[model samples]
Target chain A: MNTPFSPERAAELGDAERRGSAAQLAATSGLPDTSSEAWRYSPVSDLNLDELRVVTGAPPAPPDAPQYVTEAIDSLQAAATVSVIDGFVVAVELADGWVAKGLSVESAAVKLAEPEEGPNLFDHLHAAFAPDGLVIKVPAEVEITDPIVIRSHLSEGAAGFTALKVHASAGSRVTVFEYQSSESGGLVVPMTQFHVEQAAKVNHVVIQDLATDSWQVGRVTSRVEEHATLSSAMIAFGGKYARIRTDSDLAGRGATGELVGAYFCDGDQIIDYRTFQQHIAPDTLSDLLFKGTVDDESGSVYTGMIHIHPDGAGSNAFQTNRNIKLGDEAWAWSVPNLEIENNEVRCSHASTVSPVDPDQRFYLHSRGVPPAVADRLIVAGFFEEALRRVSIPAAAQIARTLIAEKLDVRLEQP
Target chain B: MSELIVDQLAVKVGGSQILSGVSLTVPGGEVHAVMGPNGAGKSTLSNAIMGRSGYEVTGGTITMDGQDMLALDTFERAQAGLFYVMQAPTEVPGVSMFDMLTASLSAQGTASTDLAATLSAEAAAIGFDVALLERSLNVDLSGGEKKRSETIQMSVLAPKVAIIDELDSGLDVDGLRTVAQRVEKLTNDGLGVLVITHFPRLLHELNADRVHVLAQGKIVTSGGPELAIELEQTGYGAYVEEETPEPKSGGLDDLFSM
Candidate 1:
């Protein structure tokens, strides 16, 4: 199979070998099929990667910058922006403070070392081109209020890879907002790894808005230290095939983790998400809630697990996934699992998959709210729990609008 | 000026007729007590009046304030001053009482009034914590607490007509007195009150203007408070005594009547 070279991997090699190596990685990595757990809901075999080439289209001209990002990024004066053009990181915007601390940003193709078992898929992503990869490390006690923005723009016929690594020191508060936007015919693969030291806090908000013909596969992992707090929120809309896999570990005593995901699917779109909240130490806590609604033949899948190890005594954890079936054909599959070996731990998991209640519809319709408006109200109420918990105000507002638009329903501002 | 008039109402549930030829009326600013033994179509009549989704009203006209109450949905009926405090309130897991009240109030198209402050003052008068106002709506609530919470909702929403079913069944003496006082306030404010109860204690406190005895889905008798005292003494035997001739097959039927 013939494939294109990744821009990131080419940076580590002479121009000639970089394309060869990237082509090899792309050729060896097949499109995901039904056999993989992550690809269960979205069948990618039909994507036909063999014929797709690396996108070479120019990035879309920046629109009026979003006010939310402008304010949130400005607050993090010490952070930098790693901008991606057609899945390739074309430029890195670094806060002068970070460049002074020996921070470096470049594209490199990392290879997976041979292990006892076969190489993991994520390592393959690392081994391929990382044209938009950024390596970040902060000193101890360097608190930053502003957020670092990693913005990705996918132009026409663009396909690329982007990866990020954020390492935070003890007692530091760092916020990162990753924006994935595309209006092109291509695929964007993004994988991020976060490291939080003891007594540190890291907040992440991932916003995905790709073109209707685009595909996005995002994977994020957070390794949390003792007494560390990690809050993550993923907001996604408008992708032909979008799936996000998030894994976090509360490895230290008194560590806390918060995971929230809100998505809207419309126009035969498919969005699937999987999250893992692991409690590995005593006195640790984790909360997970992923809520979404599907309309217009759209579908969503949410599978979450909270694993409490035997050593995780006094661990308190909960996982909830709820979805509203808007379209007669729209579907959602939610599987919540709890594995607990400790006797003193408290854990519960619940999942509900049902159409809007007839009674609730009648209740709203009786109030002069038209049937369509009534349905929107119920769907909005369905996701209100997650929307209220979205830490970013602008993100929350956009989520509300996206939900309304996906349903093709309009709401008078309350 | 306001009245809930049900004319010859017939209702069916699960393919069985539970209420037939049932006709009753509750006028404005009055407390009407409907007393019947279990399975006598008491709750079915109330549910039919409020236009519950499943109950099939085979034949009836329910008019409130000379308007077609039967045409309204449950919440619309409520918005038009009709309230149904269920014998067993539905459990809303994530909805808080405070939020439900505000939403309901807004749905009723009420504007610019402080329901929370009014409810707080009422709760203080009833010796309940203002904090109880923060609890989830009927979630993790005790039977008595659920009843009290419904009572608070009625007080705060201030519907035009309140239909309270078995409000005293599960309450302690103190809780019962508190609800009775709330009902009195509603009636004082000119809202029609229809309280359904099998016992005389609730009516004794309510001082219902009309006492209707329902037997076999019909109002067999209607009178003042004395009617309750007479039914209590005669054990519904007087009505049967004058009606039943030859008591050979009067086993379950007689027990049900009593």
Candidate 2:
């Protein structure tokens, strides 16, 4: 058993009902090990559960707003901004127009009462520790023109857990930008669930820029109904061990899902990603592209699988993952898998791990670009393909700036 | 003298001699054409001068404005006022043509903003489309467009010495004429040029000051503009002899022994 949950501690946290269910589940199942397929190529064995303490009670007041958060809000012109500090929702602002249009934010208990698909130790741990969560819901057929921004910051030595559920009604449209950032050592587990109804369109982007000593394990699970479209882009550039697992389900015919991610890590950091694209209905389509770069002693791991069930005949899927290793010590592992149960389906997967192209470097050098500057340009251009697919101008710009800053540091290195 | 000089240059590629004891010179303000047969090592010389890897210069003294170029890296050579138009320009997916041109110009201490205006004006003057400037470097461009884009890059950098290898290979009639006009314009503006081509039309259009015929890794002939016309009419067959008959499978020793 993990750790016995004290009922008195749950009462002190003021969420005994939710914590009870999480305790029951945690008592039954333990953390995943390297032998588990989902945890392969990850640093799961290195995680120390004893060092983590459950954060409870009222969330401390947030510190002064950081520059990046302010800049992202201004650039995106967000309709509603929600701030979470130390595992609790500190503040939320819903624009007057959005409020009139039936957009609402509410505090709720963790809803993972029973084990559903893709349940893990982190989910139960979050439910047991997190006191409250923020839910953003859009009404049927309504469209929110401006994005909703959720910004999270974890203080030093604080192990924070937070949950977010986004529900878009049939024929509705919404875009959300989640920015996770910190400057000190900590642990943060954030789980986000999306329910995209029939004919609805949703765009979600997660940008992670944490401190070098921080660790994050994030999970994003979404279900798409008939004719609905789901697009997600993950841009990560921080953390000692930052990982995101995305599970996208196309449950109805004609549903479409697109996933793209770009990440860069330096120092001794590690960025890991595992994604599942499940096509359960006929004629559904899914496409994924992930590109990343690692410099110094940093490394990255990407493993994704596209599964087309028997009912998924006439479906189409494509997955591509490309990585660049900048230094001799830098490493990358990319594995793309495809599973098809029907003959009429069309699926393709490609992966590559290499250093920067020498021919490209020579081409730039012949044109008077110095070696270091040439590398910076090539790395920036490497991410441009996915950056252009972001569809959100402000989010794309934010990603571009972060990547450029990282390259700048690389150039300044001895 | 401020001239691009190649003195007794010998180059090897992968342990095979490609350019042997080749010597030539193109002084400032003159256009020189190196006309040769298909295997005449014209491209090898350009690669050797630009310090492309795998093209080893065993013996050579390549100098521009009295500065030794063989010792410099490719980018350093460019900084020393040497530019090359490659036969097959690489496609860089994310870097735009404008970005490359600006970066090159900035290396020469010119502000990118100021150079952008000049580049736009030059593009207009040369009849090149300005929309291509926004595209990734050499990506998804037509053959002729890639050549013209290289020319545009040349106009932006304004290097003192430029080596253009087979600039007319992928060009149409109009493209050839436009490129010839640009070459003449740049030459008249006092930029020395060395043109390597199989056809004489571009050299004739540029009013080349000299023409050198390279055969078997060496320059066997040099002349004025009339040589280009002569080579165009006679082809390279007259200068190159057929391979000598095989050794007769050691017939002389067999006959003597018998």
Candidate 3:
């Protein structure tokens, strides 16, 4: 946990990678400005980057995961699996001649996603101090329906930045499941980009079950081409402060994008989500649904924007976010916005912040269910809708199990 | 055999006196019917027994079998063998009918290994839509369907005593007959029943051994089932005058109640 981001580690990078990191570091002075609309109401301003030792040395050996994690992976039976500890790719296993590669500094620098908007502080830091990661590239005209799984984990008292890229060629189909777990006092920043070519189908589900004391700030930028579809879901249950910004840019005509974010927080943990559904072409469609629950003193924030460009005529976009607060002191904030520059487009947004319904609780109790079990049943049932929306069946099953496990803990204390 | 006895029950709800001096008895294996007009404390009696919030039992002893029910919570009373068929059953979203039955049966410690098949058969018997077994419990269900769901629950759980409050409100002739048959079937198995209804239509199908007139929070008169037939013609105008005007809930006054 020493100064792994020191000048000695900086000297390890090649000339081009070093120059790219230097440019990013010089352009961004500090953390992303919280006053900006993109960072409004976020907790990143409270993050102490100096307190974290950004890893740039040889990554440590991956630790033995807890039984639950291994059980989840065993249930998946994924076609290909990759493990990245800290920032280094430690293991990769493929079946049926799958396609994947260990990412290098050169490839990581090239795959880095820098939008028209300037890169923020964490984004800059990721570019400056990232190590070897993983890349999944599906060949054209091929169909790999089985998921290509990736496990990214970080050790205690250190920060990890894993750069990952996924490219689905034309007429190809694939699925990716990325699961992240970290130790206490860990800071994890993962940058991912997906290029879904024309007429392709790509699905990605990310389950963030980090330790309750860890912090994570990540981003996913995906682009869908003509006649293609991109479906993404994120299930977050742990972390002191976790935030993920997801942007699905429909850049081709007749492209479609579906996104879902489901999370539950307890005991002062904060979960934040920011999403952008960018309809850049005509005849595009995008739908987003985010549902979450906050208990104890925890809170959450969900702010989504649907932008339909002028050329996006005949586009249809919808955004809905709902959150339930279980504790008297818990809070949730939902803000949805629509920016339409086309006359023929249709767009709608909805959000709500409510508590566990008393009438629902009473009905369950009157049926012989205990008060604590009644609450657990209501909350478990509440997430069924969001979990069913997960495009991957296996991921949905694991998410459901994780949710039940958490509820079981509640049952024990109750 | 089970018995439900209520002695001099007094109740208040949301700063309004809903029931006072209400007393009734339902012995094992018998069906007793209570007929009353709107806001005459029929629903209040059932609500107070079920321990609904906002309904305070100022004074009463609700005993089931032999234990004091007032000392137990709603679920404890339910697990102790009591069920109430509400007039307006609550719609619990995200909880499917199957899940509700599973949790209830499990909590009751009587979950048969083949619950799916038993529930399917019981739903068919109670005239509940079998296809609705997959949907959220009572959510978006029609009034009759909600009533059928409640009846299905009663049939599945097979509690020792059941208090039916206006179960015939939204049922058609066929639905009413099927529900009555289910209730009668349970009653024959030593289940005591206390049914409250506004119309004689349900009694025509249900076999009630005794009938009582509950007006103004008190049971004014009790007689054989013939009283239900006679009251169908004469109404509560006869016994209502002899009883004091307790004014439990005036017609317009109930509308403003919480």
Candidate 4:
């Protein structure tokens, strides 16, 4: 079958036999058209797959962590840290009795988990082109006090593919924070998965600050078992057209999950999100909130779905999406949905797309605050609600700093 | 110190005259009260002097310290030491009192040192919760809390003239005393006071130097603080009888025709 990719491009992707077969399969299936519901409002046609030259094979030598990655680790109190470049795990440091796997040269490669429903065109493309990645698998009953910091700082390769999976054992507690950046986040498809065993707890935070002219199409999927809990937060500040699709399953009784996101876009960027919360067991609960701001002719889209089956009786589910448009041309689309087939359940959803409250602006002015400064404060304050819901302590502060930097470029002028 | 002078102020809101030839002076280091019954154009005078939108000054002159105040924006007017504590201050969610006060002072290049300490001291003086100073600005606060909170803000700015509307409406006896005492301290330090209220209890606490009766879109009379006591005894019956009927309202038909 003729494909957008060259056969040699597959070899450039990886020497792994698994990758070669996956690439061949993707060569036949090709990318998804906009007909698919998931591809709606997405810039799928703009993806020039053959243009990205990803470094997928083994490195020439043991690579060293870049200054940015090393400095970020030093500034953070990390129980373990892993740095990856162009899909290769280059550095790993474990401290204070925390054990993880797939961080060494012999065992760096991890088998990608295919979605049960089937792999989409992007998933197959990711499997075909991805290289050896750092997979942090935690042992049972071990409680980690600090975050397992994962830095995917890929700038050399024009684009790359990375897949990270977290498998938390029963009765264990762990926190993971992932930071992704590139000259742009590049035209990469990064995938993440989480499996929370019975009675375990997991907290995850993801921050994306790609440069202009970048495209990041990513997926994060998780399953929570009996009595376990999973909480996740995502913060986005850059990317020309970035999209993340997340799916969480409450598969066991008494399981719980919470999802939060804080995103800011400026200068022709479009940050999109589509999420699903599946309640499959009785007495399960799931809550989700995503808030963002669009400025300087930029736009954002948030579409969420919640499903409660017959077994999901006596469950609770909630979803809320709020956005502030700071520029005259800025825009947002917020859609929240719910599908229930059960009788005893509590579910609600709310969404808003508004400019800053004029009364709030006037109140600040009444206090002698300048109009420009009052605007900056209100925009910064809009993120406090979503940021406080993040379990990771450092996520809020880091997001605040990045937001302030973005505000400075638009505000600080004569 | 100089006085805030409103001369022959005739203002219209939405093409209806609310204040007609109303004039008063709030000199620094003295308290002046504007008392009247409801719909007597008291708040309109305050809103117009502060240059709020929708309050059009059809014919008037408002000057402060010999500077033409109408040429300045509302925030610029505020930056130049004009402070007004409104009747019901609106809530701004997610913006902390610290953020507002810090930016308020810093925007003016004023000394914002020890802002939290200053807020705590001022809030405690008005019997307000100090912890609320760290929370969002007036969000979820009770009516009395908002009044006291505005008083604290008044103390923080220490403006030359403070135009307070309904200062005693939302306060209990104790709350009113403490809030009045805080403002009294600032007034003693040469801060001019323009307290607008229908009740005379706050005027007694404030100890006004001048009292003006505003009715029929104008000030009908002016006297010493003793005038407030006299109005309290006699009520606004005589002044309200001089109703300059609104031309737009054809009295009986305007109320029941619709």
Candidate number achieving the greatest DockQ relative to the actual structure: 2
Which candidate leads the pack in lDDT? 2
TM-score of chain A of 3: 0.92
- Models 1 onward score TM values of 0.79, 0.93, 0.89, 0.90
Across A126-189, the per-residue lDDT of candidate 1 in tens digits comes to: 3454453566666677776656677777665555666677777898877777777775667777
DockQ score for model 4: 0.59
Please provide, for model 3 over A1-414, each residue's C-alpha lDDT reduced to its tens digit, 9 standing for 90 to 100.
123354445546545566466534634466678888877777777777567765666567667666766777778778788888877777777874454422111233435868658776676657666776677777787888667888888888678888878888888888889888887777898888888999999988999988988889888899999999999999999888999888889999999999988899988889999998899999999988888999888899899989999999999998999888887898898999999899899898999999888888878878888888888889888887788888777778778878888778768874
For model 4, the docking class works out as: medium
Assign candidate 3 its CAPRI class: medium
Please state the error at residue A350 of candidate 2 in Å: 1.7
TM-score of candidate 4 relative to the true fold? 0.90
What are the runs in model 1 whose C-alpha is more than 4 Å off? A1-19, A48-61, A65-127, A149-152, A211-213, A249-257, A277-286, A305-317, A338-347, A357-378, A387-398, A404-414, B91-158, B168-182, B229-258
Evaluate residue B98 in candidate 2 and report its C-alpha lDDT on the 0 to 100 scale: 75
Residue B159 error, candidate 2, Å: 0.3
> Clashes in model 4: which pairs?
none
For model 2, what is the alpha-carbon lDDT of residue A90?
82
Interface RMSD of each: 4.5, 1.0, 1.2, 1.2
Error of 1 at A71 (Å): 7.2
Writing each residue's lDDT as its tens digit, candidate 2 over A1-414 gives: 655344445556766776777667766767677787777777766766666555666557667655765776788778898888867888898899899999987777657433345567777667677768889899999999899898888877677888888899999999998888874777898888889999999999888888878889888888999999999999999898999888889998989899999999999999999999899989999989999999999999999989998999899999999998998999998989888888789999999999889888988888898888889999999999999899677778888888989999988988
User: Chain A TM-scores, all candidates?
Assistant: 0.85, 0.94, 0.92, 0.91
Of the pair 1 and 2, which is ahead by DockQ? 2
Over the stretch A1-414, how does candidate 4's per-residue lDDT look in tens digits? 455444456676556576677777777776667677767767668776666665655444223443544455567788877776666666777774554532211225667667766887777677777776666666677677678888776563356677787888887788888877776445767888889999889999988877767788888888999999999999998788889988899999989999999999999899999999999999999989999999988989899989998899999999999999988999998989999989799999999999988877777777788888888889888888898898865666778888888888878765
TM-score of 3: 0.89
User: How displaced is residue A85 in candidate 4, in Å?
Assistant: 1.6
